[model samples]
Target: MSQFKVAAVQAAPSFLDVAAGITRAVAFIEEAAQKGAKLVVFPETWLPGYPNHIWLGPVAWQMQFVGRYFENSIEAGDVHDKAIAKAARDNSIQVSLGLSERAGGSLYIAQWHYDETGELIKRRRKLKPTHVERTVFGEGDGSDLVVKDTAIGRIGQLSCWEHLQPLSKYAMYAQDEQIHCAAWPNLKLYEGGAYALGHQVNNAASMLYAVEGGCFVIAACALVSKEQQDILCEGDPQKEALCPVGGGYTRIYAPDGQSIGADLADTEEGLVMADIDLSMIAYAKAAADPAGHYSRPDVTRLMLNSKPQRPVMAFDETAGLAMEAAEGAAAEADVVEIASAAE
Candidate 1:
């Protein structure tokens, strides 16, 4: 499709409850569908919530929520994932979801893209968990850096800080990605301190991604509720200065780096919808396509290994044993032939 409407969800997760979060997400999806959204995007780690505690407290202090966080994280094809897929299927809308993925004993900040039929089209983890994020999340691999051709367009995504990685962004651009989902945690100024992370920085990152990639950017950010801040910072006096509320700044950007639609209130929980014309990408690309004519392949080239990283590889034990036996028999025959020659 050359033109369509898309939605970016700006809301807090249901704290650390997967079921509650799923229910909330489905509601958002259905609402977006009702609003005529072809694709809906959610904030970073929307399911079961972001681990703001890691940034708020020391490791020893943050230990309290670790188990709960793990317990609430979604496993691929598990009940939580199935629920999300069903929601997309029921609404007949494509969904791009940010979630905390649990596997074995470790957790990863993951994104799940479901097609209109609710079939998972892409699943990716953050290639490198940013700063404090490393405390609770595992790194993704090259295979995660992929764009899928969909009914909407060639869609691809990168989690929170992945936008900061130039090579990663170029990889997506190289694939002719037309729709980009830039997921992020709440961008807030907790203490009004001089060192606080500014909203400008995150917003610029998304805009730059659209400009450089020549694609529509759906910048989805989560909102920090006062209750969530209170929960995370209950005992520590520093918590007040750490997990402040009102950090949402969800937006959509055109391929030329212009903001799309009406801006949502920073503290409000809602969807930011934008009607985008994919043909605009051509105009933007003509100005500058970093991965295309605007680039110098001889001066610099990127080697991308898209092999999926796995901790284990299973082989058929019966077949392996038979192969081993055959090899042993061959060795025995060689030895016998040598012995006969000697005699």
Candidate 2:
């Protein structure tokens, strides 16, 4: 928990291409590490890319790319995962990566942490997908809502709109998260009508989270390139208006809600590095520590289930054999009773 430099990336993924994304991400990691970054974070669903089509047109229209999306979505311990980890290890830096995780037939927005040595440490998914996101991604269990104690600090993350979830944010803060990665899709609106969902408001939400939780916030936002928009909005005439390009605004905020470094341009693609002093967290917490002196356990408390939920639980061969033996014993006893009665 000492002073260290952290990097946040605002870059475009190789839309629907996991392998290309891995290569691009590795290059970015190397670039950031060269700049003396101890830790680096990427935007939500940086692998392949965020489902921008979901927000552009109807659900039926978005279905066209689902196949390619699924094919490119990465699985934990897959080749792409190993490559990203190796990148971190090679650079000698800790990494927090965001990607579309494919588990079975469903996809989940996930983040994986790699230690400075390139060892996989913790993996977490988005507790809930927002609005159109639900169309493509599945919900994460309580276990996904967590923080890990890393060489950098107590690092935790939440994807996109999860930053608005009061309970979710409190859950991480309660874990004493020292560095929070706020992973977000590109913050482009159809017409900038809902400014809250736009870059400015989303950035504000990240800064507020940092101040409230007394943690350094790495606001990693994805970039939506013109090419990506054209592809996602091909059939629709409202393409330009609905899916405008260049909405990457990655920034780093201190515990006091102050920007740690120069904010990246909304249209920029690169890493924003900031040297964060963990000691500053003490100063912010001194005024109002949400999980410490400021909380009221007597009145209200947050409860986390943290259980890995699944549709089915499998049993081993030993358990199956045990059940079979008991059934056979019962059948034999019934036969013996019948034979004795007949006698």
C-alpha TM-score for every candidate: 0.91, 0.90
RMSD of each: 9.8, 10.8
lDDT of each: 0.87, 0.85
- Candidate 1 lDDT tens digits, 180-230: 988998888453663336578888999999988899999999988877877
Cα error, residue 222 of model 1, in Å, equals: 0.3
Candidate 1 is scored at a TM of 0.91
In terms of lDDT, model 2 sits at 0.85
Question: Candidate 1 deviates by what RMSD?
Answer: 9.8
